[model samples]
Target: MTYDPTFDQTRLDQLADQCLADNTGTGKVIFLSDDEDNRLELTSWRFEDEEAKARLMKSDFKLYLLELLDTLLVYRAQHKQPNASRGVVSVCKNQMTVQWVSRAEAERLRDL
Candidate 1:
């Protein structure tokens, strides 16, 4: 599958907006996709006053995230290394980062 730069940028923008709306303060959201099991795990943290911190529920943003993930999967399937078992997406404000993880790395993250 060819990479769709336009689709990816749009979905990523939407995801960033969703995160900003859901978080009351500076926040970071991490999404982990387990390709082997077809699962997506989300972890979100909100920081306030450099002291107060809380984990935010990501249910409301799942749809947007899934859309982004689906697009990424298509692109990844065509280009990723065989050993890559997980896709990691990290978002903060309007910035986003994506990377592939090995099965062992995915498991280690899940344990944390």
Candidate 2:
């Protein structure tokens, strides 16, 4: 997972597309509820000040999140075990943590 705060607005959309493709071959999807993004949303409101722009930016963030959620669903589906364990491809807030989900899958994705 690469994290660059300097990314342009299209970054989230690109992530979304990747998720859609990855999930198609992966597994079943269940969308979890949103968490404490309200505070983050408020902070965003403080930064942009304009509701319209903030709403658009917020939507983009959600699109990326939905993509990630779908990817999780697909990856879980590939597992043979019925008892599912939740995992995440999360980049820490400090952007320093990376826990590889699968070595083979990572390698395969890298080849692409």
Candidate 3:
């Protein structure tokens, strides 16, 4: 068997709810429009508990997911073929690959 990362669906739903708390079911990750080569852009996403997001990001599972996502992001950034879209990402309790799907799709998963 191989090692894989997994995320909790309920936690994700809660996170998304928190992020949209003030904005009414909307969130944004802004990309700067400046030419400063090394300047980092500011971004924001609402989460109920800051620690929760921080903990998730700092987890070993997240580290693994980021590694996987990095490859995909790099490919997408290089090609610029497909437009980026908003969605949710989830992982099964006993699965390897992460599942990236739309909000409706996620709702279906949650219902199941």
lDDT (tens digit, per residue) of candidate 3 on 1-112: 3212223343344443433233312211221112222122222233345554465445554444434344433433344423222123432222222233443543454444
Go through the candidates in order and give the C-alpha RMSD of each one to the true structure. Answer: 4.8, 15.5, 12.2
Total clashing pairs for each candidate: 0, 1, 1
Candidate 2 residue pairs in backbone clash: 27-74
Residue pairs with backbone overlap in model 3: 19-46
Give all candidates' CA lDDT scores: 0.51, 0.32, 0.35
lDDT of 1 at 97: 59
TM-score of each: 0.53, 0.27, 0.32
lDDT tens readout by residue for model 2, 7-109: 3224434564543332212111112222222111101111213443334345554455545444433343444322112222332221211132343443343
lDDT of 1 by residue, 17-49 (tens): 766454433433334554554444443332342
Instruction: Write the number of the candidate with greater TM-score, choosing between 1 and 3.
Output: 1
Put the candidates in TM-score order, highest first.
Answer: 1, 3, 2
16: Cα error in model 3, Å:
23
The numbered model that scores best in lDDT is 1
On a 0 to 1 TM-score scale, where does candidate 2 land against the true structure? 0.27
